[model samples]
Structure formats: structure tokens, C-alpha cells
Target: MKIDFEKIAEEHIEGFKGGEGRLDTRNYVDDRARIMYSTLRPGPKSGKHPHAGSFEVMYVVSGELTVHYDGSEEIIKMGQVHYCPNGHQHWFENKTDHDVIYFAVVPTLG
Candidate 1:
């Protein structure tokens, strides 16, 4: 199937943080995979959380973000990607001075 993405900016925007309040999401379920598009604002964070039943893979589409996982943290900037395995704790934040866009993939019902 083909998916048009022109209206994603207005349809799916949740889990916003400080600086600016916006969360854009485009969720698609394919077989058992759930694909999503998320946008974050500067000085905002996804906060610390854990993936209960899914492994989340994220691709940074624009700007920069700091990712914390397991017991360490790293900056996943623009053009970079990161993966958080299932049952692991992770979090992401836009500590930079610019906006950031990212795409995430997870399992259905996860």
C-alpha cells in the first residue's frame, strides 16, 4: 500500500516537551511492525522510560538529540540512528538549540 505523508505534521504529535509543545506522529502497522514518525522540540525530552515488549529503532531525520540507555548515554544527532532493545530502559531529549525530527520502529502491541 502507498501512504501519503503530507498531513502527518498535524495528525500525530504527542509526548511533547519543554521549549515548544509539539509531537507529530505517523503510525503504520505492517504485519507485526509498527512504524512511527516523531518530532521533538529543542530543550524537550522523551524522559526516561522502558520498552516493555518492543525494540525501538530510531532514525534522526533532523537536528540533534541525546539518548540514554542501559547505563550510558550518547548523542544521536542528525543523520544518525540508534536502537533500543526490548525490555530495556531508554530516553531521548533535544538538548540542542534547534528542533529535531526522528522516525521510530517498534513491534505491534509493544
Candidate 2:
């Protein structure tokens, strides 16, 4: 099946998990997964939080992002992907001057 994000997704500004600044997100949710096309301005971050019942994968669509997980951090540039497994904590920070664009896929566990 195909999902058309532009036609069906809802956009919102949210400060998820205590992150700094607001995040612009176009999201699609279902019983199996939550898919998001997200953007963040430079210096803002998605706050750290544990994935208690889901695993999340983020694919960088533009600019750069730093993924922080389990006490370590990695820079994910355009075209890169980062994964946060269930039961672990993670966050994303945009350190560049440009807006960071990414797609996040979070699948339900069990």
C-alpha cells in the first residue's frame, strides 16, 4: 500500500519530550506505525525519551542532525539513517545553521 503524506498528513508545531524550540511535523499514524515528516530549526532539539513500546528509525532528508542515544552521539547527514531500538532512549539535535528535514518511522512493539 502507498501513503500520500501531502494529502493525508496533519501538520503541527510541537515541543516533543521537553526539547528546545518547536518542531514542525507532518504526521501519519496507524495501528502499526507512526510516520512523520519533521523539521527543526538550528539549535532546537528533540528531547531525550525512552521508547518503551516502540522502535524508531530516522532518515535524514536534508541538512544534518546529531542523534544521541544510550550515552553516545552520532552525526547523521543527509541520506543517513539512525535507529533507536525499543527500551532505549534517544533524541535529535540540529547543530547546523540550516533547517533540518527528516523522516521518522516508529513502529509499535508487541
Candidate 3:
């Protein structure tokens, strides 16, 4: 079957916000691969958190976010992709005027 990405976005990812930890799964194939999107409010932080199994890949679709990772920080802007490897803890904040939006592939426990 074919997929309609636009309709999927409206149905799965619309009205998402940060600080609320909204993670909507658009599509999942084989239970191992998935697509998800998130939206963040201005000046919103993800709080101090750690990934027990860190193997996440993300792409910033719009706005900007400062990621606090491994004792340092980096500003991830639009059209940029970032990877969070294993054992690395990170938190992110929206440091821009507009809302921050991003998509990622996260591996979940079976």
C-alpha cells in the first residue's frame, strides 16, 4: 500500500507541544523502525533526563534548540540532524522565538 505523508502529519502530529512530552508515532514497520514528531514551546526545557538506552537520531525540521549534552551544549537549528549515541545524557530547550519542531527515530524495548 502507498502512504500519504501529509495526511499522516495532520492526523498523527498536529497540535503537539513541548514540555508535554508529546510523541506521536506516525508509522511503524516491523516494530523496529518508526517515525515520530515533536513540537516545543519557546523557552521550554526537556528537563534533566537521561536515556537508559540512547540510540536516537533526530532531525530539526523547524526552529532551534540548544541541546545540553555530555557536559556541553550545542545549538541545533533548522535543516540540521543530530544523533544521540549510547550512554550520553541530554536535555534540550527551545531558544528561539518560534516554536521548535523536530522528528526522530527512537528504538523502543520490545
Candidate 4:
């Protein structure tokens, strides 16, 4: 079906996944997946962690995000997508002066 993010309330998170700083997120979660709209201020990071039972895919809406995963780093800009496979470690950082806006989805596994 359709999910309207505007109807979702924002959740302000600090040190998400054990990282530094805060992020604004609106999320919808079900038994199978978690879909979220997220924004990170400059100089903030999503803590590095491993996805043990799911794969996460993030789509950049605007600005830039530096993604670290599987011993590598990638810069994802607007219109780009990054995916971290299940059982992999990953994190994201916003290093620019602008806010990093993105949509991320994680699908749960059995």
C-alpha cells in the first residue's frame, strides 16, 4: 500500500546505534521491514553496527552521506542508493555543511 511520511511523527534520536550526535527520523515498522525517513545534521554519524538478520538499503534524497561498510567507504549523494547486505557492518556520516536527508529500508529475515 501507500505510506505517507508526513503523517508520521518525527523521532529525535541521539547516538543512534551507539554513534555521536543526533538525528531526526520518521519511521514505519512492521513484522517484515522498517522504512524510515531520516535526516542527519552535518558532523553527525550513525554508529557502526552489524545487521545480523536483515539487509538495509538507503536512498539519498538530498545532500551527501558517507557510508562505511565491509571495510570500505563510499560517498552517496542525491539520487544515489547504498545497500548493506545482511550480516554486514555499516554506518553513515554526514560530513558536509548541509543536512543529509535520506530514506532507509531494512527487510527482516527469518
Pick the TM-score winner. Answer: 4
Ranking by TM-score: 4, 2, 1, 3
- Residue-pair clashes per candidate, as listed? 5, 0, 0, 0
In candidate 2, which residue pairs clash? none
Question: 1-110, model 1: which lDDT tens digit per residue?
Answer: 66555544445445543223456667776778877776777766665778777788999999887888997988998889999887898877778888888888888552
Q: Estimate each model's TM-score.
A: 0.77, 0.92, 0.68, 0.97
Kindly report the root-mean-square deviation of model 1 from the true structure over all alpha carbons.
3.3
Candidate 3 global TM-score: 0.68
Instruction: Please identify model 4 stretches exceeding 4 Å from their true place.
Output: none
Better of 1 and 2 by TM-score: 2
Ten residues in sequence with the least summed lDDT for candidate 1: 12-21
Q: Note the residue pairs that clash in candidate 1.
A: 12-24, 12-25, 13-23, 13-24, 14-23
In candidate 4, what are the lDDT values of residues 1-110, reduced to their tens digit? 99999999999999999999999999999999999999999998988999998999999999999999998999999999999988899999998999999999998899
Residue 23 displacement (Å), model 2: 0.6
Tell me, by lDDT, which candidate is best: 4
Relative to the true structure, candidate 2 reaches a TM of 0.92
Q: For residues 1-110, what per-residue lDDT tens digits would candidate 3 score against the true structure? A: 55544556433333333233433345434455556666676755765556655466778989887888878998899999777776677777777778878887767544
